[model samples]
Target: MILEVAVIFLAVLWVVTIAMFMGHTKRQRTLATQQVEADSLRDQRIRELARRLENYQGGTIRMGEELHELRATVAPLPDKITILEQRDPSTLSFAQAARLVTMGASVDELTQSCGLTQAEAQLMTKMHGNG
Candidate 1:
């Protein structure tokens, strides 16, 4: 009778140990699956950020190129204005005639000081003289 009781006790103990081990294994598998999903989400987020960064870099480069082109186009304007001022004595005279006319100079004064023709002096006085 004693030997039979001991055998039954050992069998029950083995069964409980096996059940506990199986429960632990199932929980470990669930945790592994959750970790895999988290890693996948993290990788997706990283890829999206990389794509946005690439687009920003591309836009920055394009804007820099446009700015350089704009600078190059405007670089000659000041020099051209200076050249126009230096090359044409008649332009200076016309400007002087216009100024004198605004200051109430007569057509004869415009003709004498600015070397304008009579018709040109009269036209400047008509356009820029005080009303």
Candidate 2:
């Protein structure tokens, strides 16, 4: 009778051990599946970010090229201004005299302010004056 009781106890212990092992294996499988899903989500996010970075880099390159082209287009403006600055002031005075004549300035005022002769002032006034 004692032997039979020992056998039954051993059988129960063996069954319990198997059940615990199966439960632990099931839990491990569930954890593995969750890990795989998390890894997949992380990879997808990385791909999306990489795509956005590529697009931004492409836009930056285009903008850089546009800036270079604009610089090239505007590069001659300063030289043109310098050439204009180096020209004779008398030419500028003549233009100023014409403008003054259009604004109804008298011949004496044009001669004093724009360094024009009285004859030249009269001619400019005749050509450009409102009156």
Candidate 3:
């Protein structure tokens, strides 16, 4: 009968529509979950990189300070040890005079700049230790 055919067709159409709606809802939920997970991962990576960058900056500052200290300890020493010795005709050898200059003016410059000897000038390295 024509009436029976129409009823069956309408029923089938209704079922199909319901099925399609459910499928679409499931896909939307899945997509939302995946988007949330991706956002969380991105945030975590950013925090990790920031921590590493801070550590690197701190290490650089410490290294610079240590280098400065080393230079200060060794650099300005020759000027401090200098003494103005007399230019006597018969004085110690050039090497010995050089040593006296190494001592922090232990022997005044006029009489004995080089009296200390080379070994003593080298020993002065201890006066200003690495610290």
Best by lDDT: 1
Counting only residues 3 or more apart in sequence or on different chains, how many pairs clash (N, Cα, C under 3 Å) in candidate 1?
0
* Candidate 3: C-alpha lDDT: 0.68
| Cα lDDT computed for each candidate against the true fold | 0.88, 0.87, 0.68
> How many clashing residue pairs are found in candidate 2?
0
What's the lDDT for candidate 1? 0.88
Off by over 4 Å in 3: 1-7, 68-113, 117-131
* Tens-digit lDDT track of model 2 for 41-64: 999999999999999999999999
Per-residue CA lDDT of candidate 3, range 1-131, in tens? 89999999999999999999999999999999999999999999999999999999999999999999989997877665553343454666555544544544443342444454445544543443221
lDDT for each residue of candidate 1 in 1-131, tens digit (9 for 90 to 100): 99999999999999999999999999999999999999999999999999999999999999999999999999999999898678646544687778888888998888887777899888998889753
Worst 10 residues of 1 by lDDT: 84-93
Which should have the higher lDDT, number 1 or number 2?
Answer: 1
In model 3, the Cα lDDT at residue 72 comes to: 94
Ranking by lDDT: 1, 2, 3
- TM-score of candidate 2 versus the correct structure, residues matched by position: 0.66
Q: Which parts of model 2 have CA positions greater than 4 angstroms off? A: 93-131
TM-score to true structure, per model: 0.56, 0.66, 0.52
lDDT (C-alpha) at residue 5 in model 1: 96
Q: Evaluate residue 99 in candidate 3 and report its C-alpha lDDT on the 0 to 100 scale.
A: 51
